[model samples]
Target: MVENKHVLEISSVTTSDRGVYTCKASNRFGADICQAEMAIIDKPHFIKVVKGTNTVLQCEVAGTGPFEISWYKDKKQIRSSKKYRLTSQKAVISLEVSSFNSADVGEYECVIANEVGKCMCSATYILKDWQTPLIS
Candidate 1:
């Protein structure tokens, strides 16, 4: 008689880790097999924006739906209003600011979650001067 066992583990999964996986066991008598698809819960990342201007801060994410996205500034939750507009399209989420001012400079975080898991990413917004380039 013979016995065998196996296990697979993945840490810090990303979009590149998504794919189909198969496991098979065979012996002199016969063979048994099993398969499953690995899906990743990707973390959000900010997209590049124009400097020293009223620009939209966008982040892209990829994973299984339905996904819920939330925005925060300096650890405080942000809501859509005249000064800020939030939009989500497929895997992309964005926050549009009406104007760039000193008050807007802070840490901005994007949180994305689904039934499987949740992940978040943040960027620091800094303004040197109106003429100076924007940094985030």
Candidate 2:
């Protein structure tokens, strides 16, 4: 008699690992085949932003379909207004702050989720005051 059950496991899957896989079982009497497809959901990743008088933060994410993106400051949800502008283009997500200052210094986070999974990345905003040199 042939065993009628099987299992497949994958760990730390990457984009290259996504593809179709086939399983086949055979016996002297007959044979059977089955196929499955593997899909990957990439976690959110922050892109390096240049710091200046104004502040902008951005992240990139990839996955299958209809993603919900949200931004948070110090664990509280934020929305676009005169003070903040949120935008999404293709896989890139961004937040722009108009006239960033000491008041805006805190932990900023971007959360992305889909039917399959959820992921987030965060960054801290720190303000530094510039000092002028005194010449005698």
Candidate 3:
């Protein structure tokens, strides 16, 4: 017989709570039983990138679920270009650039999102404008 109806009500659920759960219900003549299993997983870490000759943004995460990745420049979504390349795997993801130029100077963000949650990391590279060279 079920002592209480509310058995799975809690404030927060975590990975530790993953296991088999049983609920027993009984009547005057017979009894019925139910069982279930649960699993809790954590979201992935943010992607990070640095400014250099060939800049690449890397994102790391875990789990077998749908994931979405995007690159942003100056808070705007960056469409596929000749200089930008994107690659991904189960735990590793990256955005590679063939070369860096003055136009690439700005805040760059890498976003990784799933049905459960999302995480983001960003880096900024500023370039100084130069004037024409003077002839002697």
Q: Which one wins on lDDT?
A: 2
- Per-candidate TM-scores read 0.60, 0.61, 0.66
Q: How accurate is candidate 2 locally (lDDT)?
A: 0.75
lDDT of all predictions = 0.74, 0.75, 0.68
Order the numbered candidates by TM-score, best leading.
Answer: 3, 2, 1
- Model 2 clash pairs? none
TM-score-better candidate, 1 vs 3: 3
lDDT of 1 by residue, 3-84 (tens): 5568888887768888999999888999989999986755444343322234567776766678878889899999999988
Lowest lDDT block of 10, candidate 1:
44-53
Q: How many backbone clashes does every candidate have?
A: 0, 0, 0
Model 3 scores worst on lDDT over the 10 consecutive residues at: 127-136
Q: How far is candidate 3 from the true structure (C-alpha RMSD, Å)?
A: 6.7
Q: lDDT, candidate 3, residue 75? A: 96
Instruction: Rate residue 62 of model 3 by lDDT.
Output: 61
Q: What is the lDDT of candidate 1?
A: 0.74
lDDT by residue (tens digit), candidate 2, 19-126: 999999888999989999987766444444333335777776667547888999899998999998999898878888776666787888888888777888787776
**Model 3 TM-score relative to the real fold:** 0.66
Can you write out model 3's per-residue Cα lDDT over 32-116, one digit (the tens) per residue?
Answer: 9999987666665643333334466666766435777788988999767788887787677777766666667677787877777
RMSD of each: 4.9, 6.0, 6.7
**Segments of candidate 1 deviating more than 4 angstroms:** 1-54, 130-133
